[model samples]
Target: MELDEFDLALIEQLRVDGRASFESLGTRVGLSRTAARARVQRFFDSGVLRVAAMVHPEFEGIHAFGHVSITVHGRASAQVAASVAQLPDTPFVSVVSGRHSVVAELRSPDVAHLSDTVSLIRSLDGVQSVDTLILTHLLKEPHIPAHGPGRPEQFDETDRRLLNLLHEDGRMPYADLADGVGLSRGATRTRVLRLLGTGVVSVTGMVNPTALGMTQMSGFQLHLETDGTTALSVIGRLEQVSFLARTLGRCDAIGTLITRARTETVDLLDRMRAIDGVRDVQSWTHLELVKEQYDRRPLRANGAAHGAAASR
Candidate 1:
């Protein structure tokens, strides 16, 4: 779909505050509430945008977080990726062109869960090998800064209920949320704002790159000749980059890039190689995205917890 200036502006504002009221959003984008609501509903109906809550796995009792690279023995890489995507602990899965046939982001509640996931992947038919890159620290994630205030010791039942409601719909109205969480409107507003300000949660809009005319999603694993900070300083500035992380593994750093055309991907790679400190770069163009979920945590009816079996 072609997005005009107004649509773009609305999207930008929603990215900052997904739960912004239609009246407030309309005011910001120079439209009436009815008009803005229509545009947003259209975007949603067409699957162009989604507003949802996302939490850092670490704060949610997740004991492990990392990327898993899988190699397939034959032409069954796509099938293997599909199988891995069904695993509950994995939230991101893609078939790509590179040394590894498939790559997925994994979140586990503990070491045992992580081990089970690894074993399951290894036992899959046509699987050749698996390599994991554990994330020691996050330099940047989504639009939020990685370094933030410390996490609270624990969440009460009310907080969990609020989080569950937001998980289902980040744009849920305060009155509805207050009803769901058994809080007054003012209290609900304050609690939600505090959760966002403290980095306990994030509510934002996510759009598929293909929906925006950027069809190619690729991964770049960088072996840097210079310090990671220097390399990231150069790469992180690029607008096409969606995810970036410094790692402790075979590659010094890795990142995902989105581009509109094959030529653009080539040009991007060339520019990346030209960076003074970038020693080598391997590009993996995604062939198929088996699964991608911004919010991996599962919500419970009682709001007792998050984390459930993986969904296909």
Candidate 2:
């Protein structure tokens, strides 16, 4: 998407606090609430935004995966990409134009699932080679750092507080949240609607993997012949997978997932590896996740916006 100053501004606003209201956003951007809503809707309809809830695997149950760099043997990278993406354990695929080009995230129930995912990869149509590694600790999953080169502007205190409330529970009602956060319900409702409309703070239905009967936690990195981040959605629907993303650097894509299938082991792995582009992998058995965040919002340090919106 062609990102202009206004689009960048919108993104910055969301980065500060995903749950900012339409009225609140309008106030910040010098537009009316209706205009702000229209602008956000346009961006969304144009495929310029993506908002998802990413959960920690170990936080919910027993799940694991392997990460590897794979090198696809032929130009049919897309076919291979599609094949690997079809695996139940894989929730994301990236076809890149470098060494170890096809990076993928594989989900599994246990070590067996890990082995199976590998076997599946080895058996794919265009796959030439596969390497495997297990994850020890997740230093960081996917995160947006505030101190990055082009990080968003410093959020005022009010933005921070508003974010804090939503991170606690994205689904919290505006009326109830208004009382908790010291805001009028109408204003709170407007603010939250803006947040959602702007591709921020996506309130979604989430289920604990363990609670759902999955019994393991893990991760993987894949290497492939071709590279790109267009296959994330295709991979996200994998049976037990939860989160899938097209990363900027490092691995082409990644997925955090859960599972409980036994016999679908080696065959699955072979099929994945054998796919056109996959060549290698490394798996990390997630022992624990120190921190997990889905854009926890933070108002401006001075709470200026929150107070202003509330008073209005």
Candidate 3:
């Protein structure tokens, strides 16, 4: 469905704060509370927007995560890509045109499981070689909340359950959230606020880029001549980059670029190349995003979360 200005505005507001009240949404977009609620429901029913919770792995004691680039033999790229996307560990998988045929993001609660998953990928038919980029720091992630200066507050079992419910439906009403976790509405609201305030989790709306008319998306790897701190600051200012991270592997950092057209991608690449400290930049055009979702491991029991994810 084609989105108009009001639809876009509502989407943008939800992206900033998915739990914003209908009154606030309507006020911002010049609609009545009833109208705003109806519009949001329409977007959800149409699959144009998904509001979900993203929990910080570090806060939950699940730390292993990185990117894997796979080179495949001639006709096998499609088969291999499909196979990788089915794995529980891979949150993001895409077929791209570049030196590597497929790229995926892997997340596991521990290193051993991660290593085993890598071995499994290497054993796949048509897989020639696999390259791993261990993420050292996540500078920016679209739906995931950034854990700013302070430490995360301690949470209990009830909090975990609340997070899981939020992951299932970010815009779930306070009364419903309270019922699920067996807490009073007022108390539940306070806990939810604390979690959001501490950056342990974020409940936000994620728009389908294609639905928003962003037709071109690519993954980029950068090798910088100087230390990454300054370069990171500069790169972070660009709105097109949805995800950015410092890594240890073939490149100093990796990020994703989403643009409206191919021309915009070219322009963005040229601008990135012009940054003072960038030595070289490699990018792969995303032919298809087979899978893309924030990790849901935190919602699962640790024992059950094993068996997939790893680096080369």
Best prediction by TM-score: 1
Model 3 ranges with Cα > 4 A deviation: 148-153, 298-312
Between candidates 1 and 2, the one scoring higher on TM-score is 1
Determine the backbone clash count of candidate 1: 1
**Weakest lDDT window of 10 consecutive positions for candidate 2:** 303-312
Assess candidate 2 and give its lDDT: 0.52
**Candidate 1 per-residue C-alpha lDDT over 89-181 given as tens digits, one digit per residue, 9 for 90 to 100:** 787899988788999987777767787888898898888999987765555568342434245454566776787788778889899999998
Against the reference, the lDDT scores of all candidates come to 0.79, 0.52, 0.82
Q: What is the C-alpha RMSD of each candidate to the true structure, in Å?
A: 2.6, 16.6, 3.4
Model 3, 162-235: lDDT tens digits are 88788677789999999999999999999999889988788788887777788899999999987868877788
> Least accurate stretch of 10 residues (summed lDDT) in model 3?
303-312
Better of 2 and 3 by TM-score: 3
TM-score of 2: 0.44
Q: Which stretches of candidate 2 lie over 4 Å from their true place?
A: 1-4, 59-65, 73-75, 98-101, 143-312
Q: lDDT at 4 for candidate 2?
A: 61
lDDT of 2 by residue, 6-50 (tens): 655765675455556778877887878898778766655665543
TM-score of each: 0.90, 0.44, 0.90
Q: Rank order by TM-score, top first?
A: 1, 3, 2
User: Any residue pairs clashing in model 3, and if so which?
Assistant: 114-309, 114-310
